[model samples]
Target: MPTIPSLSGLRGRNTRQPAVGRIPVPMSAYVVDCAVYVDGKRLPRRFTHADAIAEVRERGEGFVWIGLFEPDDEQIQGIAETFGLHELAVEDAVCAHQRPKLERYDETLFMVLKTVRYIEHESPTTANEIVETGEIMAFLGRDFVVTVRHGQHSGLHGLRGELEADPERLCSGPAAVLHAIADRIVDSYLAVTDAIEEDIDEIESMVFAPNSPIGAEHIYLMKREVLELRRSVTPLANPLRRLAEGYSPLVPDQVRSYFRDVDDHLTTVSERVGSFDELLTTLVDATLAKITLQQSTDMRKITSWAAIVAVPTMVVGVYGMNFDFMPELHWRFGYPLVMAMILVACLILYRTFRRNRWL
Candidate 1:
C-alpha cells in the first residue's frame, strides 16, 4: 500500500488500537487502485487524486477511474470534493445502507447497488443464513468515475481487470462503468437464486416425505429469506428501466442497450424469487394440514381404548358389591362364568375398534 504523507497527522491521533500483535492499518489503504485511461488503454503508472484530476482536466481525451473499499468519511471527503460529487449522494456513499437506486444530481449520475453472495447451509430452516450482502455506489461524471464499496462482497478487482482487458468495450466512457457494475450485481442475483433453489427443492421433498416430515417453522424461515432477496433486487427495476429507456445523457444509447440486457436478467431473477416465496407458503400450509390430521388420528385411537376399558371396569365393580342377592355370587361356577363373559365383551369391543381403523 502507498502511504499518503498528508494523513500522517491523523494517524498520530489514532487512540483506538487493534487486537494483540496486529498493527492498525490506515484508512487510506482502502484505496484499492486509481488509474487514468486514455482511448481505452490504462496509463503507465499510478496517479494521486490531484494528479489524476489534473490530467483529465488538461487532456480531454480520457477519464480517471478510482476504486475504493469501505472508506471512512475523513478519507473519502477530499476525493469526493475533488470530483464535485453531490453532498447527499456522498453521504449515502459513506454511510452505505442505501437501497438499490439511481439518481441524477446535476451532471453526475449516482447509483446504489446491493450485491449478494450465497452462503452454503445444510438445510432449509436455516435459509436466512444463506445470503450475504454488500453495497457498491458508483458516481459517474463526465471526466471521471468513482466507486465506493462497503462490505465483503462488493469489491471490483476482477471486474476492473476484465474491463481493462477489453479496452474497446471500456471506451464507451463513464456509462460503460455503470453498465458493468449493474451487470455484475444482477449476475450475482442469478447465482444466489440458483443456489437457493437447491435448498427449496430439499424443502419441498421434506414436505412430501412419507412418514418423516419437516415442520412449518423451517418453511416459514425460508419464506423470510426469499422475501429478503426480493427486497434487495426488486426496487432497482424502475431505475434500470429509466436508464435503458428514458432520456439520460450520462447513459449513452449503446450503453442503454447493455443496461436493457441487464434489466432482462434482473426480471428473470425476480420472478424466480417470487416463485420460491409462493412455494414456501404452500409447503408450510401443507405441513400444518398434515400435522392436524395426525393429531386427529391419535385422538380417535385414544377414545376407542377408553371406551373398551369402561365395559370391563363396570362388570368387575358390580360383582365386587357384597350384596347377598347378587346374580353371579350364588354358585361357585358363577364366578368363572362372569369372568368369561367379561373377556368375550372386551374381545368384541377390540374387534369393533380395529374394524373402524381406530386402534
Candidate 2:
C-alpha cells in the first residue's frame, strides 16, 4: 500500500484542520479510488482491479468503490469493459441528460439517481437555480462497486466521508456502499423538500392577500420552477419503486430495509411536489378573481354617479324649454321650485343607494 498523502483542506468544513495520519486522497478531478477494508483492517488505499476481481473470483467477498467525476466516454467505456457491464449501461452513463432510472443487466445493476442541493437564497425552488444534480449511475456486481457522476456532489462527498469515518459498514461488502449511496440520495431529496415547503408558505401568504402586487412574471416563474423540479425528480420513483419491490439482485435482503425507507421519503417528496402545483394553480385563480371583483366594483360606482347626475340634468332640461305655454317657465318661483325638485330627487336616490349598500 502507498503512503497516504496529506490534504491541505477538505471541503464542507466550517473550520480548517491540519492533516492527520494516513488519508485516502482523490486520484484526479475525475476519479477517486478507495480500498474499503482488507483482512479485518481498513487500509489507506483499499483495492485495485486485480484485488477487486480476485476477491469475487476467489473468496467471494469484499467491495471496491470507484467514484468517477466528469468522466469522458472513453473512460466510461473502459470502466464498463473492466467491470463486464453492458454496453447500453455504459452508453447511458456517458449521456448527460437522462432522468433518474435503473436497469438490470445480467449480474450487474445500473442505477441512475438524482441528488439535489437547494439554493434557497437564490430562488424559490430547486428549478429556479442550478442545483448540484448528481447522476449517480452505479454498477453493483459481485464484489465491485462503481459510482459515476457528472460533477462534484455534496451528498456523494458526505456519503464517502461518512463511510471512511466508519470502515466497518463500508468494509462489510459492496452492499454497504450501495446502501450508503441510496441513503445519501434520499437525504438530498429531504433537503430539497424543505426548500419547497418554504416556498409554499410564501405562496400561501400571497393567496390571502391577492392584491399585493404579485406580478405575472412571478407567477410564471413559480409555475415554471415547480414544473422543472417535478420533471427532474419524478422519474426517480420508477427506480425506487422497482428497488422497493426487490427487483434488483444487487440490492441485498438486509439493504431492502433502507431502500424501503427511501421509498417512503420519495413518496413524501412526490406529495409535496403535487401540493406545490396545486398551490400555484390556486394562486393564479385567486389573482384573476380579485382583479375581476375590482373591475366590477369600479363599474358599479361609475353607474351610480351617472344616475345621480342624470336626474338633475333632466329637470334643468325641462325648465329650459322654449315653449311659451309652459307654466313653470314664466313663474317667478319656477326656477327655485325646479331646483328644489332636482335636489330632492338626488337626495332620495343617494339615500336609496346607501341603504342598499351600493354606495
TM-scores for every predicted model: 0.87, 0.71
Residue 174 displacement in candidate 1 (angstroms):
1.6
| Residue runs of model 2 more than 4 Å from their true location after superposition | 1-27, 33-36, 39-42, 46-60, 122-134, 151-155, 215-220, 302-359
lDDT, residue 213, model 2: 60
Clashing residue pairs in candidate 2 (N, C-alpha, C atoms within 3 angstroms): 35-46, 35-47
- Compose the digit string of candidate 1's lDDT tens values, residues 85-157: 9989999999998899898999998989888888887776654577778899999988889999998878899
Query: Which stretches of candidate 1 lie above 4 Å from their native place?
Result: 1-27, 125-128, 316-325, 330-335
Q: List the residue pairs that clash in candidate 1.
A: none
Worst 10 residues of 2 by lDDT: 123-132
- Residues 69-167 of candidate 2 have per-residue lDDT tens digits of 666666566567778989888888777567888888999988887667666564342244533455677888867788877655533666777777786
Best by lDDT: 1
**Model 1's TM-score against the true structure:** 0.87
